[model samples]
Target: MATLILAQKATSLAYGPLVYAHYLQDHESDLTVTVEWQDVPEITVGGDKTNVVLRIGDIQVVGAANAVHELAIMSGHASQYTDVADQLPHWLDFTRNELASGDFKQLGQTFETLNRHLTLRSFLAGYTPTEADFAVWGALRANKIFGGNMKSGGAKLGPHLVRWFTYLNGLPCVAEALKGHQRAVESTRNRVDQGNFDIPLKDGALGKVVTRFPPEPSGYLHIGHAKAALLNQYFAQKYDGQLILRFDDTNPSKEKMEFEQSIVEDLRLLGVAADRTTHTSDYFDQLYQYALQLIEDGLAYVDDTDNATMREERGAGIASRRRDETVAENQRRFEEMTRGTDYGLTCCLRAKMSVDNPNKAMRDPVVYRCNVKDPHHIHGYKWKVYPTYDFACPVVDSLEGVTHALRTNEYRDRNPQYEWFFDALKIRPVHIWDFSRLNFVYTLLSKRKLQQLVDEGLVNGWDDPRFPTVRGIRRRGLTIEALKQYILMQGASQNILLLEWDKLWALNKKVIDPVAPRHTAITEQNLCVVNVLDCPALPEARDVPKHKKNPAVGIKKLYTSNTLCLEAEDAAELAVDEEITLMDWGNMIVKRVQRDPATNIVTQVDLALHLDGDVKKTKKKLTWLSMLTPAEEPGLVQCMLVDYDHLLTKKKLEEGDQWQDYVNPVTEFKTRALGDSNLHDLRQGDIIQLERRGYYICDRPSTTESPMVYLIRVPDGKAKSTAAKVNAPPNA
Candidate 1:
């Protein structure tokens, strides 16, 4: 082991090596790098302005361009620094030459390049955080300080770039560098300290870390929405910050008070309480005023560009003729849009960002749309024009004093556009954190597609057990604890993978399997009647624990009688004169078997109660139901057991695939069964498990038209097999 020396400034010039040094220092407990240091020379012998230089024994390197590059190459090869040393070179050249240019246009292009690179990644160069990220991020940070245009956060920076930049800056070491060691003085602006469980922030918000989870109340929330909610909840709790549940209900065409109220109920059911529930509708007047300010400042104009042609022009990088509309003319047309007249519907307010930017999102996107079909969910028909999500989100987030905005990476393209609004409105800028969108394979989580299933009568409704909505999964017997555990386990990762459903259901089993009460039900069709020749004349009832492994869960009753019932399938397997064990009862010997004359289906069986025989000797242990006559108290109840298959045939549906062609031919199946008397007391929405069958949720309790309890089969871990035609293979 030999000494390695670093002689560099803590300034932006040496920020690349500085960030990497900080990362190396953070992981010092896990690493072994002998090091030494020296002060920076007054001036470089060479013309290079780079601040960092390193020396390891015989090897010497100068400037960040060479020092950072050689640090990666030689450290891994000869000095044994870290594996990241090898890959840092690839990113250094790009950062030093391309990213460090400090040119506004090059910065935009650089942001676009970085945005595409970080689409589904957490780091710049590898699966784990590496020096490459620090090198590149350092250059970006330096640009932010020296480059005034970048500091203002215009439409030039892409969303993913901003997201990654924000995430890196949140790192403990990076944060220390950002805020400096000022004990008595601090900038009025906040440092963006928000991210995963591992990302550390100082003393929680108290009241400083204000955050919000904005949901558009157009449909019921699905599992994907749960991810967004839970992540926001995680950070809010992590920093002791306030989480506001703001309904982004700006579109009058889709939003309804019914949806608004349902969303409230759903969030409550999820066990997440917002510090306060607010709505984008709350800021309609303020947003309207902001729009006027944009026009008056020549940053926005009214465009009558047809929908199709506007898209074509955007793709072609062609400017709209309305781009040059005078401020007076634009405001006049905007006033018409607010009136909801025929011409108003055709006119839209567009931002004046760019018409030929390579990024299509910056190509003068629409800011407002006109509609007056129905009263707003909160405002009623008092106003006609509505701000687009792009315009409202950034504006309201800043207006509400939101310190950090958690956005799904799906909005990565329009990030620059969002910042443009924040700048044009001249409000406090909120930090943007983009996490990957949640996606599950073989499941449809889209509210729009789910709505189609409801409208087309393909599914029961939004709360149908087969659907992936929160209400649907709960209806299917998934516990809220299990749902939360499953989602949070995914962590704050940025990787977007199509997850399998088993992982989620498996978590549910951990929660429900322990506490869910146990009951009994025998198939109604082809039930076998057995005669216990030497049993007590009268039926005997005894109390039995619901869960054998968890006795504290309480108990249910079991009855034994001379005549009992068994599943026809179980009886068919029994041989005449062969002794078998009746679960909960002693061994019984099969004396005779009776069958239908034509079909040969087991119809009846005669057995002798051999109480002395060892139950362990029997290979066949059966779940039997004692015959309860119509005269028995709290009598047996007939019930329907239902199970379902995936809605789509493919494991992962591609964008080009037709939904109609992939719809499962048969998704639901039902069977009739006779449940124990105790089951009669079970009500709808109760989760229980049958002795020989699987877990179930009581979908419907006894009613005049439907007397039997309806038990919807809830999946354990494996996919259930159905006898009906299935698009997926058996057991899928």
Candidate 2:
């Protein structure tokens, strides 16, 4: 067990003696910690209350809680400073007092009170890692000797707290004893966070890569987006190439500033910071100039055709009335476009391409449309015309010094137009690589479809866990490593294939399995009760390797009571008197089963835990929570489990399908769990696997203290589980 040493001067002040606690843990080969103490108090020996209080006041400078929980733990008292802290002090005080009095149940209630509604890395302070934050983490662990917010309180702060603890523990000489422990880890496949990979290409082949993830700021990122971001980041990093992140903010009607901010954050969370972030709006001037150049060269013209006329012209290869205008007149009309007079639905600049081309995208595509009323996100409406992507992308690529234009095959027919724009403008050429866009079997990756879901309120906003945006994926707990692996594994190939969602989930599991801490929880459901019947008093279990291969992550399990809850499903499968292995705990036999008839829910499960001789029996295996486990016995716990499905039901979504009709009714499920108090320390972006369930991310914390609602990545497509060992992508 790690030892904590406290140095203090005793006093009878209203808040008790001022004390400073220092946590000490050896930097053994198996553990590591580094702590930096800022502004340590100079030597001050004071027996009087006033003198000690002044010293404590100085300590506060180094220790303002970074967030609510952290602030409360350090200085919250019942009478005087209650208002300065959050509202949960009564519960926390009660729990702390009870734990002091050896009342385990009340202690659990206290943790629940303080833990409820806390957010992960949700900083109340200006920056992170404040003294209050560390103090609260330490207090929670200390207060945890009583029990935690698992049952009586519906919160589970253990995993998040533990993760936070681990991170802080690595902060450069954290705990004096744990200074060098993390440095001795077995593997350090650290990846580049910036730059593009410089891959050598053969003649006539694209050599340098210039990949861009053009996200329209319509909504927050989703999980699928994380995959794309990481993929682009990985290729750029591996080949020493440039990765450009462009905001495809063509449709300003739905885009928002919040989404723009979130996109930056999502990329940061994925660990691949873009080298250069460009906006589609940035090229408006050049795009307009190119359009004018096109008109002068007889390569484009003004199209006054209304929507219906333009539609028919595009459909039947019918030339619009203005297509026959003289080149000088067309150029004059284009100049009029820049003057912002002919605005809105009536006027547009169309490429003067063949009306009878085999490829429809080549038939007089509208290069610029007038938007007079729309206010630009960055630049307020200074001009009226906006460039279409087909025209703007290649133009911007040339101007931005982009080398290879990588896009999905959906733009295959538009490549010629891309080339045309480059040639007509007399700009340097850009190579194009058309790979098949990612298509998940049960999910939609279409930006248009996703936008509809956001607009129609079919799900919670853009970052809704069901969405495939990168922010959504990070919120769903999918790791950057997993996403990078999955994306690159697709290998910049042109072949189109529908990837199974299970593969995505499986990859996530592998990436998370190694480093995520192990925790345990039993839900409110009866079958998942925690009752320790045969375990020895004060049992000791190794803090399981957070990642079996990475020694830097180590989490000790928390155990309590004599009874634990099992999942209702697992309870149903257990036959009375049948034997099963209890995960890492060997084997056990079902002694009895109880159910609530009205709810048809399992009320309780009684198991005769097998010890010693019968541990090797192979009849079956099970995962059980032990009530006999003490506060120090770390274990895993059940939490709110959420599962997501695609919003659209059909394979190829119809233009007008009601997105709400296809909404998966069952998107989230709640279950009580038992895991280590360590979970409470997890940071906002940490990714880990919850045993039996898929991988999850520590999303923003919820009420009830435990970072509620771990973003889960359940299988989306049906793939039969196989015994075949799957090989992870390289560096995953």
For each candidate in turn, the TM-score is 0.71, 0.60
Model 2 C-alpha lDDT per residue in residues 323-441, reported as the tens digit of each score: 88999888777767767774434678888878989999889898887776778787777767778778888888888877766676878999998898777789998877665667764
> What would the TM-score be for candidate 1 when compared with the true structure?
0.71
Alpha carbon lDDT of each predicted model: 0.77, 0.57
What TM-score quantifies how close candidate 2 is to the native fold? Answer: 0.60
Top candidate on TM-score is 1
Candidate 1 lDDT tens digits, 1-732: 223343423355455655555556565544333444334433353575435556566655665655545544433422443544566667878876897675767767777888898888878765666657777876776676334545767346666777777787777876654343232122211111122455443333555787788988888888888888888887887777789999998888777777778777888888888998899989999999999999999999999989999999999999998999899999999999999888988999999999899888999988898888878877888999999999999999998988888878888898898888878878888887778887876688777888999999999888888788888888888888888877766767676778777767776777789988888889988899988888876888888998888999888888888889999899889899899998877898999999999989889999998889999899988888888533556777888888887788777888798777888878877788888888878888888889879889889998768788989887887645322236433321
C-alpha RMSD by candidate, in order? 19.6, 25.5
How many clashing pairs per prediction, in order?
Answer: 1, 110
User: What ranges in model 1 sit over 4 Å off?
Assistant: 1-196, 200-206, 629-632, 703-705, 719-732
Evaluated against the true structure, the overall lDDT of model 2 is 0.57
